[model samples]
Target chain A: MGSNNSLAVRCRSLVKSYGSGDAKVTALRGVDLDVREGELLMVVGPSGCGKTTLISIIGAILSQDSGECIVLGHDLQRMNETERATLRGGQIGFVFQMFNLLPSLSAVENVAIPLLINGTPQKMAESRAREAIEAVGLGSRPNVLPSELSGGQQQRVAIARALVHDPKLIVCDEPTSNLDHDTGVAVMDVLRGAGKKHDRALIVVTHDPRIFQFADRIAHMDDGKIIEVTNGASAL
Target chain B: MLRVAVKMLMGDRAKYAGLVFGIAFTSFLVTFAASYFTGFMTRGFALISENPTVDVWVMDPAVRSVEKTTNMAASALDRVRSIEGVRSAVPMALGTAEVRFANGQFQSFQVIGVDDATLAGVPPPKDGVVPAALRTPDSVIADPGGTSGKLQTPLRPADQWPGGGPRLDVPTRSLTVGDELLVNDHHVTVVGKSEALPRFPPRPLLYTTYSNASRILLPERRRMTFVLVSAAPGVAASDLAALIEARTGLRARTSDDFKADTVSWFLENSEDVGDIAAMLTLAMSVGFGVTGIMLYMFTTENLRQYAVFKAMGASSRMLLAMIFVQVALSALLGTGLGLGLCAIASQFAVEAEYPFRMMWFTPLVSSVMVVIVSVVAAAISARPVLTLDPAIVFTGR
Candidate 1:
């Protein structure tokens, strides 16, 4: 497969495993996937079904054992550690299930981290972070620590952090698994609205089914492989 | 990112204080031990330091230090004075004398006898008293160290008993001009007080003429302990000393060489040096242990946060830099605080006449030790963070 302008990520027959000898466990076995620009792609599976592994490779944080995994016109296998870190810092943003905001920092400071990582000036990064937080309805309390924020508010801060750097690709893992039903839906609304842009792709890996309607397309995984791909309500 | 690292470290106030306290304690103890050792070594050569004008000291070959001397025959002074580079030579007698206060209190003192003609080795008296004061018959200059302590007598005759006997409740005062004392049964009068450097083993000092010393101290055939010499205007002290040693078959050393020999003897024979070394080693080890363990605990507690940073595109180098900055700040702050505490304590030590002197290189040495401690701490703490897998951020707990 050749690179495609429309596709933000393209993977073919990717394989990854952990450990060695009798204790070895394969995490991804010849997995093929495509995430298109301007689309919200959700990989859903039961626990230990390689949803994290697939998104980790696409996020440029983990290397595949074999096969082709290209992210944003760059082949993952050919990039060195520094190049991969530059790719992740400059082009990709991540949101996690734990809403992993550095607890020592205020909400705005946490949101400004990705931009700071990308070498943006501190004043400009914080200004953009404040704007992103405002867009997510967290403008009133940008100076509070993460521990002081509610689960829903912290998730909104995580979304603001992902969008503040204006990265071309955003990877989210179990973004709503730690929130309640209504809060999870509200967080999804904020994430999908602010995160997905005309030239960007958002990949969310979730076991939570409550936010299924937010995905433009959902890929179901089982035993280290993508078993099926289906369009969600947004796509229809 | 540097701000973030600082905030993370300062966020936990208790751990930050603990780390700083460990380093500060180490610095204070190490500095204190080193300064005390330096003070003792300085005092080890107090007699040499007192006579700065003397270029060379000629003594018997068996004399290693001024504190442990072997006296020479009276002819040794003539032998040294006849050398080509010798400008002047004076006899110096060092001996212990038992002095009886007016109230009959007996105390031992180190008596130094200067030459009658030049008074070469006598420390200058306080209050502008001239060297000619030694010319008075049976007159000696009592050092402040002696007068302030062992030479104190009852202030008034009435304070003593009716028969001039000692009274336990009498108010006492240090001896001054016109005060008389009995030295080895000979009546001697204090004509002046000398400002003398403190000595190791802390003995009171009395300076008198060589004739008076011969009478006051135990009689011996060899009366001269050393021949103090001044080199000619164009002569180097070391060269003059070598020439004297070659011609006279006596040991001759420049003042500096004699001082070094004194310190070497102390280091080889004294337990004080060993004790100070052990204390210094203990302080450094404890500093390393406490700081290293505390830093490792701090890093271990924040491993997940580091993992989050790692997952958020932070390279291992960035994380390492953060740890280094944290440790550097702690080391600097702790060193400053420790030195400040030592400065305060040294004031009290001086007032109490304790051996304490902060040499120029002491702070520099302490800072280097603290840096080593901080580097080791940062390395120990960074190991876990550097090896952490960012993938752990995806896992729960």
Candidate 2:
């Protein structure tokens, strides 16, 4: 993909590290990547590679050490913490492998949090959260706590939370790694349906081959760098 | 967000309860301790506290407290009575005398002598109206020590060592209207037990007539320890005290000034109340530490949630406010539980006649402390969340 008016995320020669001196661990080393306005892209790699780190940098959750990185036409490298938080909150969504739904909140409330953080009125957020949850196919269990849900069901709730605020970009880090083979496929299908919108883009970092069919493009990472970009799972 | 914050706390049932219990224990300790110590301060002036009718107390110029008095000339009573604005003056002889108990033990007492004609400054006999004041030469009245027979009619556990000191538990048998005791080797009958001053290190108190007390005390000259005087109508006790002081050349203090003098004396001379002060200090330190630690652990455990909120665009101020709400709510809930316990305890303390008054200001002051605890606790827990990178949500770390 190329950086154009519709590009949701763009980066070139970005770098990042964990520590300093003898303890330093370089996580990202001069990587370039792009995703159009409406696309479902997956970045896959081995466990120690920088697949998660790259997605984290793209999501504005982590700052790169040095780079030109732009998401939704805004340069992340130049922004302060407060501005980055505002951008991430209003424009991005994140899904995790562990399905980090707060144990204290019910499924709908967990899904409603992003909207609440975005300053939507609570009643409106909850009503929208119900629709988002229903879209991901858990309408009957809106009030259930995360602990009560099965692995696949909880991931679906995580997906609902990511989609509820209608962000321009969604990032998933091993979103299906915890589920069984069949359950992972099911969750990937729901994520695929939600990610392929004209105004939004999706990026999933995964090792699971079962859900590779859902990605419009796949970026392979190795040793803190992107090694290949394939058009679809057929290039696997 | 604050509503969610509270619901979040309520959701963590086991931890929430633990946090509340910690705060409740702190609250109970501080509130009850303050009330208890403030009540104890009044015991320093228990003398005039018992005799509410006496407006002015005339004693020798050297007298500092009722417990530490010097004998004034008996003629000072006549002098005070003749002063302008003086309504009446009656001599009261207060002295410490040794009385032998049935246990073959002799205990010392602060003996009181009331005027035979006026019976002024004498607490009424508990069972009946005032009888002829010490008609018999060798008769003495005992004080039931503020319990007014509660100590006799089935003793309570708290009264066993009430006001706790060595040699204070000397009342082996309760006194009655006709029991005989020896005061200063002189045989005396217990004419009637009455309610007297509430004192610490509660010694046995004995009362007799002015003439008989003069004989028992054997002061070097004809003397009375004090002249209990009242102000005439439309006369301020303080105003009348100056006139009596000028006329009698003796120390004349209104009840309030005398009470203040006694308080000042006790504050300077007494080391016994230091235990209560120490307990108060311990309660406050523990309250601050325990409540702060519990809330800190609670916030540290929930640090990830705050980061997630931060990642989701909640400002540091907003998340900080949420944590503050949790701390404030827990403080109020716990303090209320502790105060309820204190209220129940106070009823029994009052009934048992232990000086445990719960002043209104204790709760007011404790609430302020709770506010401080809330801010400090929240600030402690807010540190991790404040500097949080929000990026932690993206990594297993």
Per-structure clash totals for the candidates: 0, 0
Per-residue CA lDDT of model 1 for A35-150, tens digit only, reads 88778889988888898988888888888999899999999999988899888888888889988888879999999988877778889989999999999999999999999999
Q: Where does model 1 exceed 4 Å of error? A: A1-5, A22-25, A222-236, B62-64, B97-108, B124-140, B144-195, B219-221, B245-249, B295-300
Residue A107 lDDT (model 1):
96
lDDT at residue B96 of model 2 (Cα atoms): 83
Taking all chains together, each candidate's TM-score versus the true structure is 0.86, 0.88
Measured against the true chain A, the candidates' chain A TM-scores are: 0.95, 0.95
Question: Which candidate wins on TM-score?
Answer: 2
Worst 10 residues of 2 chain A by lDDT: A1-10
User: Which has the greatest DockQ?
Assistant: 2
Error of 2 at B290 (Å): 2.0
True contacts kept of each: 0.57, 0.58
- Give candidate 2 regions above 4 Å deviation: A1-5, B56-86, B89-91, B115-117, B129-131, B146-173, B218-229, B235-268
